[model samples]
Target chain A: MQVHELRLPLRAEDIRKLKEGDKVLLSGIIYTARDQAHKKLIELIEKGVDLPFKLRETAIFYCGPSPKAEGKVCGAIGPTTSSRMDGLTLPLLQQGLKVIIGKGERSAECERQIREHGAVYLTAIGGISAVLARTIVSCETYLWEELGAEAVYRMELDRLPCYVGIVGD
Target chain B: MRYLKAEDIQKALTQAICQISYESDPKAVERMRTAHEQSNHELERDVLGAILENNELAAIDNIPLCQDTGCTVIIAEMGRELVIEGATLQEIADRAAAEAQGKCPLRASISYDPLFRRKNSGNNSPAIVHIRQVEGKRLKLKIAQKGGGAENMSFLMMLSPATPLEKIKEQIVQRIVESGSRACPPLVVGIGIGGNFERCALLAKEALFEELGRKHPDEHYAALEQEILSMINKCGKGAQGMGGGLTALAVHVLHEACHIASLPIAVNLQCHAHRHVDIEL
Candidate 1:
């Protein structure tokens, strides 16, 4: 029921007080990645390829939004079901990604990774596409343009609403 | 013979798909609003708000309600005397479905070889089409864009004919409680009774396309629907399972004659975003 304000490059301690149902308003950067980008990112990490951005102290949002029409930063962006990314979360956690923003329940392995890595998973209200879209102050494609909606789009978000749905505690 | 052109049916199908994705049936929307009003818990309230907001955005922006636009499933009824001309009915339906998926760019959820090398079919093709012949000449098509989440929660029960009606009701409500937020509660519960196993399950799923809160013409079945809805909502599953108000907005029960020894029951859970459209051509 408590709504906390979060800043970019959030620390583990900052998210430690949160539980599975606490809501928060987050401001700062988030990177978008869906199934394809996740596959590629994990593969790159396995092959020791350099990542475009530092995974440490960053929140990854699982989303695949519609194309930008007109001057909008993105179209109808919302958190996707999180379970699909269970395979990638552990490695990303090991790589220092501290927060995962998505919808739905996480796998036990993902929760274990979060606990071990001092990370958390936050849930944005699912189906609030336009509300989430309005939080995007800016967005740019960082990779995998040909993947269409699955392409990674780095976002600068302001006062985005999310609930800490899974905690290390 | 009552004649219907293939083109008319195809166009109607396409329009039905697009319309349902954004504009939910009025009855379903009304029931959702009522569920929101009755709910007391914050989490359930929040999920309801998000769902309502999604509906608004989808309509205002002409976007599909959910990214998973779902595989094309058409329930078509034609009069016994009606004739479909110009192309095979199935072929026209398939082509229309492909066109709808592409133009709408609905998520390509369908995969080829669902068992082994599951390759994306690219166009969400090979729609699930059900046809039945009736006595009237008028053609009716009902469409429901079923998401994977709720579809995965569907279950069938081979209940003994002697099983108490109360127990059957308990199973349906318990299934929703177990599903919690997984099937996206404040769901629409569809129950099929009396048919054979597979047919019963299909009947339950098809029943979901009916207007929310609408009851069966059969008085006994309608009473059961009301009872189930009240019981399920009282279970505290609430919207998206965060707790508080109604777990389900409606309970639709459909029944058919069956073998004397068997009472096959099926439950098909449908999320609150229940997208469906109807066309009479």
Candidate 2:
């Protein structure tokens, strides 16, 4: 598998270079969202309400942050199973979410959406959470703070590693 | 009558919960290491290695091996001869689990209500505890921090007793194929056969507590385990579904006698990080 180092808010055009099985170490800002956050975001989009953050040219990590240990920026952060959010992905992709990082496979419809919408799906190692957590440079609640761990977390990543699970055509 | 203090049981459960969150279960680690060493494929090999490395890191740093601290499951075999002093076993277990979850920095994975509120319980209390009365004076408990990903993929089926061995094999293989990487491969497949519906499901979960790579005592069941393991590996859904050798580390079959016309089967998948502890008091 090929290895690539790309910084995030990855441009849609740059995603084409990443094919399935390629490895990537991403460094930059990405937002965290699990199924709950996805639902809320979709509801906001459906109501024509402006989201607090822009979705275009952005990397969204499927994750829920634990309460941070005393000095660490985050705690035990890792990819949740991505297929849980499969149905909610299309609208975000349409809004120009360029990179989606999670663990495990996606549904056929989710795959088709990524292929058509100029987005890529990246898979991180499931359960190897602490190693992944160390890559977080900083983390803060970006939205839906009342949702606790399910809230959207704005994080700066320093060489977060993952494999390409699907590619945008 | 031998006296077993309620406080002692609570203490044991609390320590076991905190211990498993960081320390790697020895047998599971051994099998994972073996899979890592034996794999010929690069990506599969690397994924296995990363899992092993993460175990070491989690232990050293005193952090959870996985972010999902998991819903607590405890199976306690209570000795009939033993008398408890302070509280019921279930109440003690609940309190112990809550204490560990709140103190150890483990995530609160349990929702207070499954449907309506979906509010986090915050302390991960009210463990799924199964208590059985036994003859001995000593108490034994198996505690598992079962994560949502693997638990969600577990299944059960009521097959016609007429269904043969090959068909049963087919059903199990198909289930794993559907699970793919979502259940997190390099899994431990626990098969519970011949019991009634609920009993079968509980048997499957109990089977997961078996040591990885240990063969069943009954020769016939041992053979069944081997056959299923081969079929899963042959499906080519490798570590994390990358397509290679060793999709599952082992398959464990635990069976009990059932009615003449009924055959029930259940499959419980435990992911690479098998976090559980056995306690004797």
Best by DockQ: 2
Q: Which pairs of residues collide in candidate 1?
A: none
For candidate 1, give the lDDT.
0.77
Clashes of each: 0, 0
lDDT of 2 by residue, A15-114 (tens): 8888889889999888999978999999999999987777874689998866776766777888889999999999998787888999898889899998
lDDT of 1 by residue, B1-281 (tens): 87888998889888777677666667767877776787677877777777777777777765667655667777888788888889866777677777777666465666667878556666667778788889978888777778766777779999898888899889877877877666766788888888898889888977897777776899999999998888887888677666677678888988899999999999998877787877888
Taken over the whole model, the C-alpha lDDT of each candidate is 0.77, 0.87
lDDT of 1 by residue, A17-120 (tens): 78778888888888988877898899999998878888885679887765455655665566666787888788788788888888777788787888787788
Give me the runs in candidate 2 sitting further than 4 Å from their true place: none
Name the regions of candidate 1 deviating beyond 4 angstroms: A32-40, A48-50, A66-76, A84-88, A107-109, A137-156
**Model no. 1, DockQ:** 0.35
Please report the candidate that would top TM-score against the real structure. 2
